[model samples]
Target: MGAMNTKVIEAEYDYVKPASLDEALDILAEKENVKIYAGGTDLLVKLKMGADLGMDIMMDINGIEDLYGVDKTADGGLRIGAAEKIWNLETNADVIAMYPILSEAMHLMASVSVRNMATIGGNFCNASPVADTVGPCMCYGACVELKSKKGVRTVDATEFFLKPGVTVMEADEILTAIILPAPEENTGAAFTKMARVRPDIAKVSISCVIKRDGDAIKDCRMAMGSVAPKPLFLGDISAELAGKKMSAALIEETAQKVHDFVKPIGDHGTTAEYRKEMAHLIAKEILEKAWENSGGELA
Candidate 1:
């Protein structure tokens, strides 16, 4: 193989690896053109792929004490530290049992080795159109906690991504943690992805969360990845299916609605039309599986 024609820029930043969130935020506020480095799984790859390198300061937050644990809040929601690895999320028994959508999504990401180093925050912060975590996180109604030198703020996952490679995060704010609400009683969530290869990034991915009340659906949330510029919530279809008994016809109808709502563009991985078709198929499959797991009728 020959050397690729990619520009290499020399590192010019004063590296600061902060041990605390406050310290990291302070550095961010004080430094000019500072970029936060988490696992660097995505950032480093983008840089190698010839992404623009414009930062003069690189602040490493992986060692920050305030952003390195997985615990439950007093209200019983899971609080995942921003620095927690995707592999840890895949294997965590509590996360597996309670947030199967997240577990499945994490398991479907790159590979075991990559997941071992990729943090959830990095996945969301990178804001890739096909990010595995975004779909599941949106379906679960997860919120991102961001901190700056002044204070902290939280934003829902559904609203985090503004466009491909863009988020609501400000330059001086670091994502501190991800907050996932506890699953409701009699609820189940599932995620499905389609790719040409087992470990490749998803061409189209869907995550469904359903809550059952007797034979009827009490709530349903569906999110799709890689089918739009950013992760999208299928709110219209969700509302249409709410309070309805699960059925093949209803599932197919809602799936079509979701398919119609998504606006995908042709890319190297897959065609736009193929993604549209897969989006419908994957959404139906995940919704049906979630309904069945939650003790709802599948017929």
Candidate 2:
């Protein structure tokens, strides 16, 4: 077990820094109980809190050349390096212009210093239910690429999370990048969260994306955080509004459905009942805002 009751890491562990993607995969394949270190905003906190990671080696992925920078794909999509700093993504030009909701969420994710040291991959892999980026990423139809010595595979963001602090990644697999598809024309997204302060973990969070087709909802994706084991993707609920005309009555009815749908237990300094209520309100708030962005007015 790691040393407990301290605000600093005292455990003895060998740290390895790989130069390239292949080199990192080789180490991951060959090593036992190896943990990937990127940015270390979350991992370092765990170590300081004496959370037993049960690892023998810590692999620092920051040095890998392939795991840096964001690039636009040929199809007007984007490929975000897993180790790209949160600060960069929060302010990236393409992100701001193309995926505005994601950029907006990252801006409020944490304080400037922590964002400077936090990696997007590390943030997703940390698997916090209320992670600001994950909800927005999923809302935008993102996918995460998992690479390993054996090969690579892609998992849709909508299908990624299994539970709190857990993903479907294998032991030898490393999340190399996050890919986002081009948004359909007339599409818009909105994000909001409720926290105790300006810079605090969320008590409840919600994100919504809507593709408008002449004032009717052509398609929609909605997600709520801190109200379930993972960020709850309201696919079925979203489907209920697809191809339907926008109206205040419809939004209000769907909000009530959402209030009954989510199962929040309230572990983050709040009560279950409070989270449930806030989840409902936040859902309604984001949904209404997203509808407005999609060129609709409640009437």
lDDT of 2 by residue, 122-204 (tens): 98898888888988898888999999988999999978899989999998999999999887788878999888897898888
lDDT of 1: 0.85
Q: Among these predicted structures, which one has the highest TM-score?
A: 2
TM-score of each: 0.95, 0.97
Clashes of each: 0, 0
Model 2 regions more than 4 Å off: 1-4
**Model 1 Cα lDDT, one tens digit per residue, 160-199:** 9999889999888999899999888999788888888988
The candidate that wins on lDDT is: 2
TM-score, candidate number 1: 0.95
lDDT of 1 at 270: 84
